[model samples]
Target: MIRVLIADDQSLVRAGFRVLIDSEDDMVVVAEAGDGATAAELTGGTRPDVVLMDIQMPGTDGLEGIRRITADPDLAAVRILILTTFDDDAYAVAGISAGASGFLLKTTAPAQLLHGIRVVAGGEELLAPGLTRRLIARLTTPTPPAVDDTTFADLTAREREVVTLVAEGLSNDEITKRLFISLATAKTHVSRALGKLGARDRAQLVTLAYRHGLVRPD
Candidate 1:
C-alpha cells in the first residue's frame, strides 16, 4: 500500500484528504498534522510514502518542512506533493527547488489529485504541462554566452532526447508515443538519465534541462 500523510493547518482539509485517500484501495492516510513541524515529526514515525503538504501552515510552513524532509537521508524515499490554494508561480518554483516531487492546486479534481499522488509515489514529478513550463520559466535565467556542454555530456543522444521531452513535460507514455519507442524503453531512458545526471528527481532534471539550454521558453 502507498502510505500517505496529510499536512494542512485546517482540520477540515486534513479530514477531507484522509477520507478521499482512504477510499483508494492502494493508498492510506497513515497520519495527519496541522503544522509543518508536527508533520515532520509524524513523518518520521509513520514513514509515509507520500506527503500531501499545504504551503501555508501555521508554522514552519510547507517549504521548510519539505526542505527538512528532503534533507534527511533516512527520508529519501518519501515524496512530497505540495497542495495549496496559492497560485503564485514562485511557490511552484520554490517547491521544486526544495525537492518537492510535485505541486498541485487545491482546486484540482479529486481524480487528478489521486493520480498525482500515485505519480509521485512511483518516483515521477507531477507538474501539469502548462504549470511545468511556467514554473521552469520562472526559475530559469538566460543561459550564459558560453554554454556548458559537459553538463549533459554523460547522456547519450537518445537519453538527451528523453530528458528534453521530460523537460517539455511529457510523461513516459507520451514520450513513448511521440518518439515511436516502447513504453519500457522510454522509462529506461528516463531512469538512466536521472542516474547519470545525479538528479534527485524529474523536477531537478527539468531545471537542468532548461539551465543547460536543452529546452527553451516558448
Candidate 2:
C-alpha cells in the first residue's frame, strides 16, 4: 500500500483528502497534521511513502517543511507533493529547488491527485501541463540563467531529445510514442539526461531545458 500523510491547516481539507485517498485500495492516509512543525514530526514518526504538504502552514510553512524532510538522511526516501491553491511560478520553482517531488493544486480532481501521489511515490516528478511551463519560465532568468550548458551539455544527443520532450510536458509513454521507441528505452534516456543535467526529477529537467534553451515556453 502507498502510505500517505496529509498536512493542511484546514480541518475540512484534511478530511476531504483523507476520504479521497483512503477510498483507494492501493492507498491510505496514515496521518494528518495542521501545521508544518507537526507535519514534520509526523513524517519522522510515520515515514510515510508520500506527504501531501500544504504551502501556507502556521509554523514552518510547506517550503521549509519540505526542505527539512528531504534534507534528512533518514527521511530522504519519502516524497513530498505540495498541496496548494496558489499556482505561483516563483513558489513552485522554489519548492522544486528545495526537493519537493511535485505540486498539486488543491482544486485538482480526485483522480489527478491520486495519480500525483502514485507518481511521486514511484520516484518520479509530476508536472501537469500548464504548470510545467510556468516553472520553466520562472526559473529561467536570461541575464544569469538558471542552468548553464556546462550542466546540460553532458547529455547525449538522444538524451537531449528526451529531455526536450519532457520539458514539453510529455510523459514517458508519450515520449516513447513520439520518438517511436520502447517505453523502457524512453525511460532510460530520460533518467540518463536527468543524471547528466544534475536534475532532481522531471520538474527540474523542465526548468533546466528552458534555462539552457533546449525548449522554450509557449
Candidate 3:
C-alpha cells in the first residue's frame, strides 16, 4: 500500500483529503499535521511513502517543511507533493528546489489529485501543465552574453528535444507518441539526461532545463 500523510492547516482540507485518499485501496492516510514542523515530526514517526503538503500554514510554511524533511537523513526516502490554493508559482519553484517531488493546485480535480499522489509516490515527477511554464519562467533570468550559448551541447540532439518536452510536463508515453519513438527510447533519453545533469529526478530535470534556457515560456 502507498502510505500517505496529509499536512494542511485547515482541518476540513485535511479531512477531505483523508477521505479521498483512503478511498483508494492502494493508498492509506498514516497521519495529519497542521504545520510544517508537525508534518516533519509525524513523517519521522509514520514514515509515509508520500506527503500531501499545503504551502501556507500558521507557523511553518510548506517550503520550509519540505526543506526540513529533505534535510533529515532519516527521512531521506520520503517524497513530498506540494498542494496549494495559491497560483503564485514562485512558491512552487521554491518547493521543488527544496526537494518536493511535485506541485499541484488545491483546485485540481479529485481524480487528478489522486493521480499526482500516486505519481510522486511511484518516484515520478508530477507538474501541473499551467504551473509548469510559469514555474519555470520564474527560474529563468537574463542570460549573459558571456554565457555559453550551446547550453545543451552536452545532450544529443534527440535528448535536447526530449528534455524540452519533459519541461513541458509530458509523460514518457506522451513523448513516445509525439516523437514517434518507442517508449523505451523515450525513457532512455530522459534517463540519460537526468544522469548528465546530475538531477535526482524528473522534477529537478525540469528546473535545470529552465535554468539553462532550454524551454521558453509561451
By lDDT, the best candidate is 1
Predicted candidate 3 versus true structure: per-residue lDDT over 121-186, tens digit per residue: 876799877776567657777651232347666888899889889887788889999999998899
Per-residue lDDT value at 25 in model 1: 99
lDDT per residue, candidate 2, 125-209, as tens digits? 8865567656666766655444456766778889988888887878888898999999889989987876776666776787667
* Worst-scoring 10-residue span by lDDT in model 3: 142-151
What are the clashing pairs of model 2?
none
| Best of the two (1, 2) by lDDT | 1
| Model 2, C-alpha of 106: deviation from truth (Å) | 1.6
RMSD to the true structure for each prediction, in A, is: 1.9, 2.5, 2.9
lDDT, candidate 1, 1-218, per-residue tens: 99999999999988888899999999999999988888888898889999998888876888888888888889978999998554656776888888888888888989999999999998888886557667766766765223457998999999999999998888888899999999999989998998999887887888888877777777
lDDT (C-alpha) at residue 127 in model 3 = 82
| Model 1 / residue 62 / CA error / Å | 0.5
State candidate 2's TM-score.
Answer: 0.86
Judged by whole-model lDDT over C-alpha atoms, candidate 3 comes out at: 0.84
User: Worst 10-residue stretch by lDDT in candidate 1?
Assistant: 139-148
Measured by TM-score, the strongest candidate is 1
